[model samples]
Target: MALGPASVKNEGTKEFDFTARDFERVRSLIYRRAGIALADSKQEMVYSRLARRLRATGIRSFQQYLDQLESHADSPEWEAFTNALTTNLTAFFREAHHFPILAEHARKKGGPLTVWCSASSTGEEPYSIAITLCEAFNSLTPPVQIIATDIDTNVLNTAAHGVYPFERVEKLEPERLRKFFLKGRGEQEGLVRVRPELRQLITFKQLNLLEGGWPVQGPFDAIFCRNVMIYFDKPTQGKILSRFAPLMKPDALLFAGHSENFLYVSNAFKLRGKTVYELNQGGAPVRPANPGKLEKML
Candidate 1:
């Protein structure tokens, strides 16, 4: 997903002639393609983000653009359509608490650990996991493998490259900067590249969570599927979580977003900590948060 400018108006002045029907069509298409439950409040946000696509395609209006999308269902533009609408706002250690648990798991599991970062927005979370694993093993080459997948093809391309602005890493300690990243020079100045050690440990791919079957082979020790669930309705969330359970080891941990409370959505997982969950056996206590009911998501 593209995290475009905050301003809703084109050139900070001209507003796209968006209509209620246009918003409804776009919302329906996005839900069908990406399983994102865009709220009615996001109408303006939808217009702002997709306005660029309209300009690029030389389409006069959202209605026509949407008509084109529906007519050409298999076109490459379909991917771009989903990419523009989905949210990709993420950063390194956005949920800092989850890393320590991952580290602890790495220590306990000893050699050859596997993890899946289910929402690899521009690759920060997976890289952070790689760094943690490297630190745990005290080597650039750790006995860990990470698979980072995201629905957005555009972001996957960026994540695969493993390059970012220097400011993105400015918060890290100097020692870590030196150990895990290479400072770019000359034309590439003010940029940092994740070291080959870290990059090699991760396999980045594009994956839509709503797909019928996944290409990944897993009994992963942990899965970081945070933030993305907020866009899904309760039933969709529950179905996805059910699919995750079989792919994960019985003792595997699941890390969720701050706002997500899966206790009411599914019975398969028990809350282990703040936004952390593990597969429930039989008598785990019930603790459901007041996760609001699913809106007309589909």
Candidate 2:
């Protein structure tokens, strides 16, 4: 007789039972720890990644897997949790319009301007920032510093390596392709790496935006936190923005994802343009002192 779905069993009569409740538990745990809210639609993805862990550990059920994750003292499961949860989609100069504006800002500032590429997936955005700064201040006295960060350590490692496949860099202009990148050769052919001079300007680190006490020493001239807030809900988004404001210099430029709207969030930042806001430290227009009062104004 053939086994039915519920009757299927393997390895000491333990049957695999993946349930919605189990999915909710894992999803909530991820959110509580990392602030990444997984949609109910991602249940299959959650099951697939977590199921691997279950098989590896010889565990039979989701509850047992959770128990192991909670009690395991030295396991790297926490890192795996973060890696599975965070979205890492990015590309070289993905948002092309932002670069020219960044270059213009660097030129106008004309000093040691610091730029932070928060959520710099796969290193493209930060390197793009570095390249623009180099082009803008080619002969200028001081140099720009680019600090790139992401929550996913896996991607940060890749970003720090600075090597990418040739197709990944297809959008780059030929002149830029020649000037800023070293084309890989021999066993590494068809690959490209950011040249040492450009790579020297950027420092990559892992950062979780929701975590308290950011390691960054800021007052950065411009913060390119683009395309990152889409995963967070309104309250979390507002909280993150408020924390970021105090760390910026007065009149520092803050860039957000194209899809994000700060209207419902903190009013401490003044709208400069589409997806760009200026944090008012002293002379610029200030939002209400109370966050509740600011919400009314919004």
Candidate 3:
């Protein structure tokens, strides 16, 4: 007799009775709520993360916990469930090449500019944008606005605080260190905080892309949706990319992750440079690139 999904069970000696069905249920729920398609190989990972939720909610089995969640569509626990499964991986200037492209675009635009960092994850990416523009325009305050958003509320709270361990920025150049952050002292030792000016340039909020209502308005100069679409399936990626189309200006630039090739996903954009994209003009005799991709002004 061959084994089936329902017949499989987690190996012996566990705190909770986790089975293949329990994992499948989790996969389905998270996929519906967040558009994340968890793989069968992620069974161990899923059990580990949600095991704490089971303890906190005082549920004996995964079945009971999931039953509770499905029973109440509006339950606050849904937020916790979503947050537990979401992954946030980020760093300052993560794909270093994109920043130079951004700085140049901002200079050419030469006016009040707006950019969106759709996956704001713990805030480093948006702050990096602020820092780039500040150096580009030679002002602590620049004529720019950045709206940074992410699905994970837990990370947003940390991002809003603007405090981080010193080790996080130690690798940054000495000039960048002095110019942009204040070293923590006394009781806050070993911590560094982003300068107030950078924080002022950003507005952080909770956003779920899978949901219908997006709270942002844009015909933005640039939009950074880097490294986020890898979590969603192809159909979901296409839907999100189509929505991003109407939100972009005719000449707007889109920055994507190095490993992400969106050419297959939508025709609204085309490759401009490595991992960087711009709106497709459909051969309509668009404006020249010299005005848009100019040499540094400072």
Model 3 lDDT per residue over 1-298, tens place: 1125534466776789887778778877987898887765577777888999999999999999999999999999999998898888888888999999999998988869999999998988999999999998989899999999999999898888889899888888899999999999999999999999999999998999999999899989999999888887666777787888788889899999877887876776789999898888773333222222111110
lDDT of 3 at 216: 93
lDDT of 1 by residue, 202-298 (tens): 9998899999987687999999999988898776787788788888888899999998888887878989999999999774433433356545432
Q: Where is the poorest 10-residue window by lDDT in model 1?
A: 1-10
For candidate 2, the 10 contiguous residues with the lowest summed lDDT are 289-298
Give lDDT tens digits, candidate 2, residues 1-298. Answer: 1113433123443346776567667766776566676665565567667777778778889888777776874568877766776777888887687778878888888888888888998898888888888889883223887889888888989999999999998888998898888899999999999888877888898888988877788889999888877776566677788788877888688988777787656777877877888875553433333323111000
Q: Candidate 3 — which residues are off by over 4 angstroms?
A: 1-9, 283-298
Computed on alpha carbons, the lDDT of every model, listed in order, comes to: 0.85, 0.76, 0.85
- In model 3, the worst 10-residue window by lDDT is 289-298
As a TM-score, model 2 comes out at 0.86
- Rank the models by TM-score, top first: 3, 1, 2
Best by TM-score: 3
Query: What lDDT score is found at residue 54 in candidate 1?
Result: 92
Better of 2 and 3 by TM-score: 3
